[model samples]
Target: MAQQKPTKVMKLYNRVTRLPYGNKIFSLMVSRMAPYFGTIRPLITELRPHYCECLIKKRNAVHNHIKTVHVIAICNGLEMAMGVMAEASIPSHLRWIPKGMSLDYTAKAGSDIRCVAEVKPEQWVEGDLLVPVTAYDDNDVVVVEGHIKLWISAKPPR
Candidate 1:
């Protein structure tokens, strides 16, 4: 069998990640593509098949009334990581969309947070794929843990 071509987003990530401030540039591009992601001002630190990592700074804009990072803001970061990872890792013949997310707030998000999403290689087949996601504060404390359920299916013929 022939090797499948990478998705457009994966190709763009590969090209941009080689330049200085490449990850920042890629993050900006992604934010522009999906303006809602711009709200968190996420910086994608890493991207590869089956995994993605993003950073969200603890700025006033993302803070809650009590002065800690808002849960929704962390959710946005988690969703971004999951979306990108699925785009990069899905089989060429398959496509995916998030169905829902189930998360638990484990601790206060008191500082900058790192969000991560991962999928096992064998989990890429068609059906509901639950991508595991987690967020940690600067002190490496788990602030949130969850899974985003994604519906994967074969792409329709042209």
Candidate 2:
């Protein structure tokens, strides 16, 4: 099989990650492109093929009545990580859209949260792909765990 060209998103990430505060710049760019993700103000710390990680700071904007990070805010971070991971990992001929998500809240999100999304190399193919996601609080306790399902398909010929 021919080597797949990098997606525009992946190319952008590669270009920015080398500059000073590049991760922050990339995160801001993504938030601008997808306004909803700006709600959580996610700071992408790492992005690579099949993997992505981001941090969501604890703040009033994202806090719940209980003074903890809201579940919805955490979900937004997870989805952002998954979207970037898919963009970086998928073959050039393929495209993906999120289908659904299933999650379990494991603990209170006190303090900043680190969100991660991952997919095994073998799982990248046409059809449904389940990307595993997890969020951890500052102390490394899992606050949320789930999978985001994505429908993968061939891109239309130009």
TM-score of each: 0.95, 0.95
- Alpha-carbon runs more than 4 Å astray in model 2: 1-3
Compose the digit string of candidate 2's lDDT tens values, residues 41-150. 99999988889998999999999999999999999999999998888889877899999999999999989999999998778789999899999999999999999999
In candidate 2, position 89 carries an lDDT of 87
What is candidate 1's lDDT per residue for 64-88, written digit by digit as tens?
A: 9999999999999999999998888
Give the top-scoring candidate (lDDT).
1
For candidate 2, give the lDDT: 0.93
Residue pairs in steric clash, candidate 2?
A: none
